[model samples]
Target: MNKIAIVYGSSTGATEAVAEKLQSALGDADLFNAESVNIDDLKPYDFLIFGASTTGIGDLQDDWEMLLPKMEKMDFSGKKVALFSLGDSASFSTSFAGAMYHLYKALKGKVEIVGSVSADGYNFDESDAIVDGHFVGLALDEDNEYNETDKRIAVWVENLKQYLN
Candidate 1:
């Protein structure tokens, strides 16, 4: 029984969609809306998948903002964790990928870094996703610009699945 948690902060449902897809790929997973998540709930899961959307100039979306302060104060100790971020590269100069920065910083020592999903080509760190350069679900609008970036997200989740199994 590989218990995993998929927690996410999404404004327009984009990030949530990605999170759900990741969950499907990874097998059975507990899903949480960031606003309702308590850090204490993490106790049961062996692995965690944190998802967030970019908002207001590279800042984490509102839901994640509420959870971050609390999550930062807690300890993940023996947890295995990964991150996935959703954002439009054009809107924020720093981009949606920046959302993973803080969470990774806070949970670094407490958990093992398994993977990360970033539109701007983030190194997956301790995982094979980086070595394979596996990126799918990269959605784009009619103009060929990243309006959604879904393919890249799918690849990101699939890569993270490697860690879960």
Candidate 2:
């Protein structure tokens, strides 16, 4: 069976819910909470979907801090990587999707950008769309005053399902 891993960090279970939904949608998936996961156990997976809930002024969740240094030092060549982030745009306007931005830059390898989502909004730039793959973003709740954020995510994820099949 093809192995896909969903490694995540969640504070209020919002990100966890998102991850579970994605995992169920994918089928044949392994879900791991970042806090209890060991790096060595990750070797069995062929693809990775990494998610983190933003904390402490646009930073990674507390449990994820220890793994950053380790992830920075390892190699992910020839691996498929998808990134998702949970954050409050209202609190940190400047760094709305900081965790995903930083992780994408740090991980070394042939990463196919799966995309990033936030509580603010996302871009559906025709130029940014990936033909053979998909880029997506989704909000955790309807708290976004403008209400445009969640709509974009739904659209993006619907587009993403095409590639998954």
Candidate 3:
């Protein structure tokens, strides 16, 4: 099994909760808070799962904003990456899960990006995370549909397991 690390940035703890669930689901994975993670801490991991909650007007969560420049500079050539984000589609329809897009743009050409989820069940006006009719990562609308989060995460993680292998 590959060494996996789940790193996340959360303001209201939604993304962190998801990360915890992922850590539990993926048995041997490590979990880290984005604010405290050092670049060197990620070197041992072959796979990375990043989670964040979208903030004001399509912005990444505060911790992610601080880490973006470092992430952009890091070499992710042989690493595999997956992304997930928490957003409110009902309130922020135009920018739902936008932080995931920011992460995707930073890591796209550098890493083997995985975990693109279907956008079929999502009701959003617009999102930069959408590519070729699919979401670039797992999208969670906890504010509007909290009940669906667990199911969505479970399904997405299962799909991600295939990609990770």
Candidate 4:
């Protein structure tokens, strides 16, 4: 079985682009769009990577918002999940990648979510996604700092391999 499942919800394709890149970088994970994802599609993988874009004032994007209740109900006890968020840090510094906060909450005690990235390189003023001194997952400012995404993903994937293998 593949070790990871990279799922994403995107309104304007930014998050999907990141998902694609993550699959390319990892080279061995399954990618699923949030709109059509089902438990069966996820059952084979022990690791999951969820990606979504932050919407108005830090709200979760539509497809991911709709998927939350279902995700919360799943038995993810033995699974490890990660998150990647896409938001405009420059325009919404106060709420950069904040929607990831909800996703993290839904899976917190249920799943062993991994890949908490350090908050060091981000230029945002604040983020709901921040837990203590780190992001809940790999946070990406694709709308504002697109150039950094490649480096960020490469580093995150490298760190992620430690958990996967």
Q: How do the residues 1-165 of candidate 4 rate in per-residue lDDT, one tens digit apiece?
A: 437899899999989989999999999988898898986788878899998999989888899998888876687767888888888988999999988888998888888888999998789898999998999999998777889999999999999887786
Error of 1 at 33 (Å): 0.5
Clashing pairs in 1: 136-151, 136-152, 137-150, 137-151, 137-152, 138-151, 138-152, 139-149, 139-150
Runs off by more than 4 Å, candidate 4: none
**What TM-score fits each model?**
0.73, 0.69, 0.96, 0.96
On a 0 to 1 TM-score scale, where does candidate 1 land against the true structure? Answer: 0.73
TM-score of 4: 0.96
lDDT of 1 by residue, 61-164 (tens): 79888888887667676678877666554444344345655566666676687763333543222221122342222222211344334565566566766666
Record all residue pairs in model 3 with backbone atoms less than 3 Å apart, i.e. clashing. none
lDDT of each: 0.62, 0.59, 0.89, 0.88
Worst 10 residues of 2 by lDDT: 123-132
Higher lDDT: candidate 2 or 3?
A: 3
Tell how far residue 84 is off in model 1, in angstroms: 0.5
Model 2: per-residue lDDT, tens digit, 1-165? 447788888777877877877776666689999878888777877677787776665577666676666675455654567777666555555555455545555663445655443332333222111223332333333234335534454554554554343
Model 1: worst 10 consecutive residues (lDDT sum)? 134-143
- Candidate 3 C-alpha lDDT tens digits along 108-131: 888888999999888889998898
Quick one: ranking by TM-score, best first?
4, 3, 1, 2
Q: After superposition, how far is residue 57 of candidate 3 from its true place, in Å?
A: 0.9
RMSD (Cα, Å) for all candidates, in order, is: 5.9, 5.6, 1.1, 1.2
